[model samples]
Target: MPKDVYVDQDECTSCGQCADNLPEVFAMDDDDLAYVVDGGNTAAGEDAIQEEIDQCPGECIHWKE
Candidate 1:
């Protein structure tokens, strides 16, 4: 099954790692916080997204259960 990605803005550091590593799925909003894009929730970019989640300094990215 596919997973849904979410970002906790309160814990986000605005580091841009997620956006940089997976632009198709993540992007930096005007507030500098990382957010999941329209097509972000899926298995298509799961590996790359997981990489970002693993390396996220803020540890704000997560797979929605």
Candidate 2:
């Protein structure tokens, strides 16, 4: 599977839902924007990331290669 967590800064609300769901992947930056911390660096690619995506109120998460 490809990278499953993506945060569109323009659309992100910085609600912390993604980080709350999966801290191993999602992280909030100093600017309060969400980003994939482990993205392509970890084995956690799809399932957990999908859960975070589903829980994001802003629906800012996406999965793509």
Candidate 3:
């Protein structure tokens, strides 16, 4: 099954890594925090997104349960 992606706003540092690395699945809001695009779910890019999750400095990215 596909998983939903999200960024913990409180832990977010408004970094652009998510948007810069995965524009197809993530974007920055007006506040500059990364947010998942397109309903926050994707069947593809699991490995790519996981890379983001691993490399995120703030470690705010997550897969929704």
Candidate 4:
């Protein structure tokens, strides 16, 4: 099974880096905060998602435990 990914919206900087890095798992809401895309393929795999988390300037992306 793939790990789930989530964004701490409060900590989001509206930078759109997560979405740009992995649109399959991340998106920007109207508020421009990064969110885990609904019904999207989080199955892009852990390393891919983690890359976004690591690259996120806001440091808001995380694996959902």
Error of 4 at 7 (Å): 0.3
Summing lDDT over every window of 10 consecutive residues in candidate 2, give the lowest-scoring window.
38-47
lDDT of 4 by residue, 1-65 (tens): 66777899999999888788778888899998888877554448778887887888888887778
Candidate 3 local lDDT, 1-65, one digit each (tens): 77778889789888798888888888898998888887546734678889999999999999888
The candidate that wins on lDDT is: 1
The local distance difference test score of each candidate is 0.87, 0.75, 0.83, 0.81
lDDT of 2 by residue, 1-65 (tens): 36444688778998988877677777899999988785432647577777777878888888755
Alpha carbon deviation, residue 37, candidate 1 (Å): 0.5
TM-score-better candidate, 2 vs 4: 4
The TM-scores, one per candidate, come to 0.90, 0.78, 0.87, 0.88
Model 3 alpha-carbon drift over 4 Å, by segment? none
Residue 64 in candidate 3 has what lDDT? 81
Best by TM-score: 1
**Residue 27 CA displacement from its true place in model 1, Å:** 0.5
